[model samples]
Target: MLTAQATSTAVSATDIAISLGLLVAVYAVLGLLWLFLVVREISHGPAPAPAGVVEEETLPLPSAGPLLRPAGGPMAGSGR
Candidate 1:
């Protein structure tokens, strides 16, 4: 009876250890896959601009028209 009990305990321990090892291996594989994907993305250059999307050569600034007024209104002899 004593020998049988000892054998059962050893088998249970081994099973638990194997289960933990398999869990670790699964997580390691997932981590490696994620690392590979990140590396691939870095190696590839930035994605191209969308089709038919136009980018301006230079940003347009507000024209110096009547919209630009000083704190004391238009300057003297500078046309209102």
Candidate 2:
């Protein structure tokens, strides 16, 4: 099988170094921005809940009706 090789004139050390430097610079900038955003969020605390909302259920749930009935009552599914 034939193989491909880089010709000296086609790819120069200066070009490679420039691209590598640009890549590193881009990543470094993005990392700093992400870190800044995280620190800012941490400095702020959790938001407050809206007023007038009940902490617990004010009405019984439909499924709870069967369980909450008096024990002596006829069986739930019985025709009686």
TM-score for each candidate, following the candidate numbering: 0.49, 0.48
Off by over 4 Å in 2: 1-9, 51-80
Task: Give the Cα lDDT of each candidate.
Answer: 0.78, 0.77
TM-score, cand. 2: 0.48
Q: For residue 3, what is the lDDT in candidate 2?
A: 38
- RMSD to the true structure for each prediction, in A, is 13.8, 9.5
Q: Model 1 misses residue 52 by how many Å?
A: 2.7
Evaluated with lDDT, which candidate comes out highest? 1
Q: Model 1, which residues run further than 4 Å from truth?
A: 1-11, 54-80
Per model, how many backbone clashes are there? 0, 0
